[model samples]
Target: GFQFQMGDGGAFEMMGGGPRRKKPKFPKGVPKDIAKSMNWLKGTEWNWNSWRNVKFDKDGTFDAPTHDCQGGFCRWSASPEGKVYILWGDAGLHELQVQGAMPKEQDQAKMQGLRMKGRRTSDGERCQATFQRVFDFEAAELERDLYGILGLPDDAEEADIKKVYRKLSIKYHPDKNP
Candidate 1:
């Protein structure tokens, strides 16, 4: 059966586009500030009822670790090839984890400026999480080495790697006052 009315005495037969898609983008020349404002407007006033349509706040980030620990399953995880993505919150930083997709160097850089989308869990309750959390430089270096998990070459021997690791550790160690 088709929905006969939109509550405004308007025929609501044949629902519009399917509820799932790549999600819509703002029209051309629409400033981001305006688009965000418009989104807020539609949400706050029109009661577009997106809560029933999409998940809670369709445009939120998914932090798997935070979510898993906090019991919030609305964490988004997307991977293409060896590249993994962990979108944080709408305003939080997006952590891009690139592994050894390339055999050269397993570089891990954290950029703090990116927008994220909302995530949905098995339950209906919604939670918002931000991605940005300042980390000490030493922690970052360890994370960088952990990337790709490929490890250094076997022929290089453990001594070489240890030397490099020590150098990095000294440079970023918090007590070093770097």
Candidate 2:
């Protein structure tokens, strides 16, 4: 049997005359820095023009809720050169070329303020998307009381929000509730 390993510890074993590759050990999900840079994409609701609202997890999973694809089964990965790839199961794969001024030594505050524009190519069709990091206080106020519903403080961290959401989801799931 022959075995091969990547620099990142991804291993391939020879089994039955074929190579069976093991999952990569590092960077299972989007890198923290990349996820943080894309946080502005949160809270966007689905529209006719877009497929769904994007949700990213630190564990490399994502959810874009829609009639077509639901739950956190989707996954995303990025390369060192700033290319983001999304494996949206059934919905198809999407490749995004993220363009922004991301400095290596900047603080989170500066990173949060970074706006980006990207060209997305999916299923042979191309489209352009722009991301703005600005917050609209008035619009947020007008939006439903998500914090209240989630039983979290307005200033809760993203991780806290996701934790609470998962807890509530399991608690109120139709199968469990019913």
Tell me, by lDDT, which candidate is best.
2
**lDDT to native, each model:** 0.31, 0.50
Error of 1 at 45 (Å): 31
**Alpha carbon lDDT of residue 64, candidate 2?**
60
Error of 1 at 163 (Å): 12
Q: Worst ten-residue run, lDDT, model 1? A: 40-49
Model 1, position 55: C-alpha lDDT score? 21
Per-residue CA lDDT of candidate 2, range 4-25, in tens?
A: 8756633443234575333332
Residue pairs that clash (backbone atoms under 3 angstroms), model 2: 29-60
User: What is the TM-score (0 to 1) of candidate 2?
Assistant: 0.39
Residue 108 accuracy (lDDT) in model 2? 33
Residues 66-177 of candidate 1 have per-residue lDDT tens digits of 3231333332333332222222333232223322222222122332221223223223333322223232333223324342233566466678778778877888799986
Strongest candidate by TM-score: 2
Distance from true location, Cα of 165 in model 2, Å: 38
State in Å the error of residue 8, model 2. Answer: 54
* C-alpha RMSD for every candidate: 17.2, 16.5
